[model samples]
Target: MAETEESTGPPATLIDPIEMSKLDTKFREEIHSMPNGEELSACFACSTCTAACPIANIWKYKPHQLIRMILLGMRDEVLSSDEIWLCLTCFQCQERCPQKVRVTDIFFDCKNLAAEEGKVPPNIVGLGKELLEKGQLYTVTADWEREDMGLEPDVPGLSVDGLRNILKETRTSKLVDGDK
Candidate 1:
């Protein structure tokens, strides 16, 4: 018996289809446990969701690809991908999905899973740390832009005590230092 390039089947000694259902089952677990797992099984691989996604144009794998990967159980690649974090959470894909797949929600789930698994990229980690420290997701806009827009230099109706209480109740106080 000789193995040829044209051999389309596994070797006779290989007793199990090691790359089959087991992989699907395992990855399916990750997908189902994701934030909106209900939609994970419904994807039909249509590119409509991807086509409607603003961020998909810039992504290495569009929304549908990410969903397909989850369906196929490609956990490591999905978890480590920058595409997961790059999602803007705009929900455009969700709205356009003919299957009603919760595309945006699933991306959120993947991001959470990646964070839980400590697989977040360094840039995201640093940004999260900064948000936690500053209690703001982004730095203040340029002073000139604010002045040009005639906006008040200070935030409206926000006080340190009010913000502290809200953050504490939301379990995000840990992101700030010297807050009780």
Candidate 2:
């Protein structure tokens, strides 16, 4: 028989095994310490949370996978991933979790951490800016439109100064000022 190279999948030499020792094992502990993150360690990789998420189909990492990554100490990967920022805070995941894990809240903590590291998405920053500047996410109705609808043009007892002051005193001010 002629000499031939037989394929047995890819050669083992081409694959690099992950070195577990290098992972930041303390990451799970840090998450658990955060408020509403206390239940993170209770997740058993159940897909219930993912199944309940309305946006999971579009997410690169499903809710269950994100929790698994956090448990595995994949801090940088989890923190920098767009999946963390994509969560809608709808609480469906949390509501469906078999372990009662606060999946949505944990994502909130991850977002806060990401924001602290200046990894926030531009749209979210813009929303914060809008809220700080206008005390509302959407524009108020104009007088003509309100009159046409037989409604008051101005909201009753609505105020923006209080909201602006609150934002100014919190980290949101820094976000609005482009500090992060």
Candidate 3:
């Protein structure tokens, strides 16, 4: 009997055969127009980005795989993926990339593209709404708790209205208002 070696590539689920219809030949160029985007094509699939990623362990598609997908012009799949949204943006991947691929920044571009398509999770949208309205995340201290701690009910010298005003003219405003 002849002996055969096991498949050395990534698991079958991580890589599917390419379909011409799913590719966007221009998607790579679209990303290239964004900051730090030109480096994307330099990726050599060394998996260094994945190895340096702090949260890669939990990702169905690690940073390197995602970069490869981007290089392959898997636009729809890349934009709609949860992995793009889940990146911690800690720069670990980018810092360790031997090719200087700017992995983290490319992911940021991918996320912005996803948001433009209204693909953001509802909770993220809610958070943006809360910030736009209140100029902060959820309340940092309860009124009653502040009073109990010998502090004023509200944080002194802190006003969110000014911040809110500036944000009103930003893209966040359009996004929160359900505009593309």
**TM-score for each predicted model, relative to the true structure:** 0.72, 0.85, 0.81
Cα-lDDT of candidate 1: 0.73
1-180 per-residue lDDT for model 1 (tens digits): 344467898756644433554454587776686568887788889888888888688889878888888888877788889998888888888888888888888888888777666676766656555555556665565487788899987677644555445655553434222232
Clashing pairs in 2: none
Per residue, candidate 2 scores C-alpha lDDT tens digits across 131-154 of 888877886776687898888878
Candidate 3, which ten residues in sequence have the lowest lDDT sum?
Answer: 1-10
Count of clashing pairs, candidate 3: 0
* Residue pairs clashing, model 1: 132-175
Deviation from truth (RMSD, Å), model 1: 5.8
Candidate 2 achieves a global lDDT of 0.85
Cα deviation in Å at residue 163, candidate 3? 1.3
Error of 1 at 91 (Å): 0.7
Q: Cα RMSDs of all predictions? A: 5.8, 5.7, 7.1
The residue-by-residue lDDT of candidate 3 on 49-112, one tens digit each, is: 8889888899999999998888888898899889988899999998998988999899989989
lDDT agreement of model 3 with the native: 0.85
